[model samples]
Target: MERLKLDVLGLCETRWSGEGHFASGDKLVISSGSPDGGYGGVAVVLSAAVKNSLLSYTPVSNRLLVVRIQATHVPITIIQVYAPTSSCAAEEIDDFYEKLQAVIDAMKSRQVCVVMGDFNAKLGLGRDFESGVGDYGLGQRNERGDMLAEFCRINGLVVCNTAFQHNLRSRYTWISPDGHTRNQIDYVMISKSWFSSVLDSRARPAAECDTDHHLVTMKLRTKHFRRVRCKSMAVRPFDVTRLRNPDVSEKYSVATENRFSLLQDRYNEECTPDELWDQIQAGITEVAEEVVGRRVRKKPPKPWISEEVIALAERKRIARCTGKDQEYNDLKLEVRRRIRCDRRK
Candidate 1:
C-alpha cells in the first residue's frame, strides 16, 4: 500500500465508532463520530506519506464531518461530507447545504480542497459529464437533487467519478435500502480547477459486506516528476494581522488616492472627461510595461490636492485660465458646488 501511494481514505456512516481495519501499509489520520453513537458517523483515514497533521476534526450536527489536514510539501486539504438521507424533509437538506457552504468559505485559504462522500441526491435528470452512461437511471428527479446540481455548478465543482461512464445497472454507487433500484448517490466532486488532478475515480463494487453503498475510490494524481531545483515549496501562515493595521492600510490607500488624483489632474489638463476615461483604459497596456521595465516601484497613489500641491496647481490654473473665461470659471464653481451637495446628501 505504501508503494501504492494511497494518501487518504474517508468513510461516512461507518457503523462502529472505534478504529476500522486498514491494510498493513496504511495509517489512521483521524476518526470522529457523534458523541451519542450510531445515527450519524463519519471518519477520515490518512496515509503515512502525507506530511501534514490533522489541524481539526469536527463532526457537524447534520452528520457532516470535516477533517482539516495541513500538508508540508503541498497544502492539500480534503473535506468529506455525508448528507442526511433523502428520505428526510426538505428543510433538513437545505440546512445541510448552508452548513456545507460555511465550511467551504472557511477553508478557502487551504489552496486545494477535495470534497467527496454520499450526497444522497442525484445531480440532475439529463445532464452530461464529459463522459458517463447515457441512461444512468436517476429515478424521478427530486427538487432538492436539482438544487444540489445547481449548487455544484455555482461552486465550480466537477463530479470526478464520471470517468467510469457506467449506467444504472453497472454505474450505481449505492443500492436502495429495499433493494428495489440502484442509485448513483455517492460522489467525488473536486473543484473544476483541481478536477485535472483526479487521475481516475470509480465506485467500487460491493465487497462481501451487507452494506447497500459501495466504496467510492478516487485516485488523485498528486505525484509530480520534477528535476532537482529547490528541495520543496511550502506555504506559511500569511500575515492576516496586517489587515488590521489601520495606519498601514490607510497609508497605502492614501498613496493610491494621490496617484489617481495626479493622473486625473494630468488627464483634465490634457483632455475632456470622455477622453480621460479612454486614456485610463489605454493605461492598462502600460501596466505590463511599467512592471517589466521597473518604471514604477509601487502602485500609483490616489490624486489629492495637498497644501503644497494646491499652490502649484493654483499657478497652473491661473496660467491656463488667464484674466478672461468667466463662464468657464462659473462652470467649475457650479461643478464643485454640486459635488459638495451630493456629499452632504
Candidate 2:
C-alpha cells in the first residue's frame, strides 16, 4: 500500500488461484487460493523491511496463510485469513476455525503472532466488557462475532481496532455496493503479550483501492531490525575484470588485508561461532565494496534491428490504423525485408 506507506498489508477475498510468493516492485506478495482460482482467497503484501528478513510462509488453503519474519526481540508470525462468509454453511465455518486453531498452536510461544484480515464477523459492543474484544466496538454482536470472540479468548488475543475509539466513518471496514449498509467485519488481532506494542489500529476509509472493504492499518513499536538483501533482490557480482591491472590488484589486496586484520583485532574468546562468521563476512564485503566495486549491468543490444526497421514498423502500424489494408500489408512486408537485409549486413 504505497499510498498509505504501509510496511505490511493483509488482504482478503483476493480471488487469485494457487499459492506462492512473488515480487511486485519493491514489495513482495504471498497469496493462497483454491486450485480452480475462484471464490475466497487471502494474501499478504510486505515491503522491503519485513520481506528481507522473511523466515518462512505457509499457504494453508484458499482462506488462510501464514508468514513469519525476523523482528526485534522475537520473530513476528503473521496469520492472514479470509474467513468463511456469514452466508456460508455452519460446517464450513467450523472447519475454518479448526484449521486456524491448529495453525496458532503450531507457532512458538516466544514468537509474536499477529492474526489479521477479513473475518467477515461483526464484533460489536457488548453489555459489559469482553475478554478478547473491547467496549468500543461498533454495532451489535451477532453469531459470527460470538464465535470470533470465543476464538480470541481461547488463543489469548485482543481485537486491536475494537480497543480504540473511532468515529463511524473511520470504524466501518466494509460497505454495501449500493452504499447503504456498512459494517466493521475486518480486524487486526494480536497476542495479549504484544498488545502493548500496538500503538494504533483503525480502518482507513480514505484509501481508494476500488474495494468495498477499507484498508486497515496497525501501528506497532519494535526495535529496528537491519534489512538483509532478499533473494529477489539479487546482488550483481564485483568487477573482477579490473584485477587484471597490476595497480588495481594491489589496491584490492591491501584493502582486503587491512579488513581481515581489523576483524582479527576485534575477535574475542567469548564471541560465538555465528558472531565470528558474521564479522569475517562483513569484513570481506567491506573490502569488495571499497576496492572491487560491482559491475554495471549491461542491457541487451540488437544492432541489426536498427532505427530503419523500427521506423518501417511504425509506418505499417499507422497504415493499419488508417484502414489502408493494402498499404499496411505492403509496409509490413517492407519492414520484414529491411530487417532481414540488416541482419545479413
Candidate 3:
C-alpha cells in the first residue's frame, strides 16, 4: 500500500483461519476467514492514513466482508467479496448474492458505498451491459456477469472501472497462469450517487505481485473534512479529582459559589437561554481552573521502573560515558534494587 500510495486495498481468497484483525508495520489488515472452507476468505488492508477513519467492520462470511470508514464529510461503506466460482454449487452462489444484497440494503442510501474484489464474473461488454455498466467494459457477459449486473441495477451501483476508458493491458485485471487467457473479472463498483466523484478506476497490469490478478486501483475525488483541532481538547480539564481532599473540596465549593453569585446579576438581564448557559459553564470552568487547577496528566509508570529508578539509570549512563565504571555499576545495582522495592510496594 505504501509503494502504491493506496489508502485502502481489498483482498479475495485470503485463506485466513478465522475473523480477526492485525497490524502489519504501518498497515492494518481486517480479515474474514472461512472456518470450514480453508481456501475462501476476504480481507481489507488500510493504510495508516485511513486507519484512523475506520468506524467498524463486519465479517458476513468467508466470502463477504464489510468495512465502514468515517471519511470527512461523507462516510464510506466498503463491501469486499470473493464470489463463488462456477465450480461451486448454484445454491452457494445464490446464498453469496443474497447475503451481499442484504448488506448493501442495510446501508444508508446517501453514503458512498463501494463493492470491490474478485467477483469471478466476466461482465463482458455487450447488450447485457446497459443499465449500470458503462460503455468502456471489456469481454462478453457471462451468466455470473448477468447476476452481478442485475445485482448492481437493484442496488443502484455503477461499475466504476467500466466508466473510464483504459487500454487492454489496463482494462483486464486477471491473466491465466498459462499466459493464454486474460479477463476483467475483478471490479470496483460504487453507488450511482457518488459515481461522478470517482476520478479513475483501472487495472495496473505492470505492477509486480505474487498473484495473477493485477492490482485494481480507484482514485476518489473526496476531500475529507480534517479537523485540525477539537473544541473539547482546547479546554484542559480541571483536576476535579482533587476534590477528594477535604480542604480542597471546601475551597472549590467557595470558589464556585462566588463565581455563580457574580453571574446572578447577568442572568437578571435580557440574556438569552444560550447566553445564560454559557455564563454558567464559563463560571464553573473558571472557578475550577482557579481553585482546583488544570489537570496535569502524568506519564504512566514504566514497567519495573519508577522516577527514582529512571534518575539512577540516567546517572549511570552519564557515569559510564565519563568512564566511571565503579559509579555506573553502583547505579545499576541501585536501579535494580529500586525496581524490586517498587514492585513489592
Candidate 4:
C-alpha cells in the first residue's frame, strides 16, 4: 500500500481475502469474491482520512463495491468495479453500463457519485495504429464508445480524468500486463451534474508495485449541505430569422462552400450544396469556442393559456414529481394537444 499510496485501492482480481497493513495507512473496508470464479475478487481499502469519512459501504456484486463517505460534511457515493477483459463480448460490457446506470439513478441527486475501477475500456483517444498521424486511439471498447457516451449523456456523468485534458505518449494511463503495449483502460468518472464539489482526480502509476495496471485517485472537496433551487423559467425564446439575414446568409454560404471544397479535395468526390452546408456547420461548431452545438429549441407551447391548459400543466408537473417517466411523457403530449387546441381557438 505504501508503494501505491492510494487513499482507496480497488484490487480488481485480488487473490487473497484477509486484510493486512501496507506501507501506506490503508485498511480494508470490504472484500467480496466471485461465487466460484478464482482469481477474481474486489477489495476496497481506504486510508485513515478516507475511513474517517465513511458513512456506509456495501458489496452490490462480487465485482462491485459501493461505499458512501462524508467528507467535509458532504455525502458522496463511490463505486468500484472490475470489468471483464477486452476479449469479452461487447454485450456484456453494455449490460454492465446499464446496471451501473440503474445504480446511479437510484442515488439521491444531492449525493455526489464517483465510479472508479479497472473498466477495461480505453479511456484513450485513438490514433493511427502505426504512424499515429490520425488522432484518437483510446477510450471505450470498440462501438462501446457511443454506448458509454450515451450513458454519460443520460446520467450527466463525465470521465473526470478525460473531461478537460487529452495528451498522448506519456498521457497513456495503462499498459498491458505483459508490458508489451501501453493503453489507458481504467477511469474515474464523476457525475457531471453533482461533481461540482469535487476538487481533483488523478491516476497513479504502479511502477513499484510492478503491476500491469496503475491506481486511480480522486480527492473530492465536498459541500457542507445541498439545496434544490426553485424552477424559474423555461429556455429563452430563439429567433431563427436572425440566421437568415442577407449578411449572415452570405457568410454562412461562403464558410460552408470553403469546407466542402476542402472535403471534396481530400475525398476526391463531389458534394451537394446541402452537404457543403453540413460540413461548414460542423467545422464552425468544432472550432467554435463553445465546443458543443446547442440543440435548436422549438417554439414554446403556443403562448395562449386557458383553464384546461393550466390543468394539464399541473398534471404534467405531478407526473414528473412522482418519478413516472413514461407518464410524464404522456402528460406532456396531452398538454401539447391542449396548447394546440387553445392556439387554434
Candidate closest to the true structure, highest lDDT: 2
Per-residue accuracy of model 4 over 86-188 as CA lDDT, tens digit each: 6878787767776777788789987778887777655346432221112433544455444555665676676765543434442456776555787666677
lDDT of 3: 0.83
CA RMSD of each candidate after superposition: 28.3, 13.1, 13.9, 24.7
lDDT by candidate, in order shown: 0.59, 0.84, 0.83, 0.61
Ranking by lDDT: 2, 3, 4, 1
Error in Å for residue 94 of model 1: 1.7
lDDT of 2 by residue, 142-236 (tens): 89988998999888898888888788777889999777899989999999999999999998866645367888888999853655667747888
Q: RMSD (Cα, Å) of candidate 1?
A: 28.3
Q: Candidate 1 lDDT, tens digit per residue, 180-263?
A: 777778777777777677777766652212257876777876652222334333323334345367865565456556656777
Residue 197 in candidate 2, Cα distance off native in Å: 0.7
The TM-score that candidate 3 achieves is 0.66
- Candidate 3: Cα lDDT at 75: 86
Model 2 pairs whose backbones collide: none
RMSD (Cα, Å) of model 4:
24.7
In candidate 4, position 28 carries an lDDT of: 38
Model 2 / residue 222 / CA error / Å: 1.4
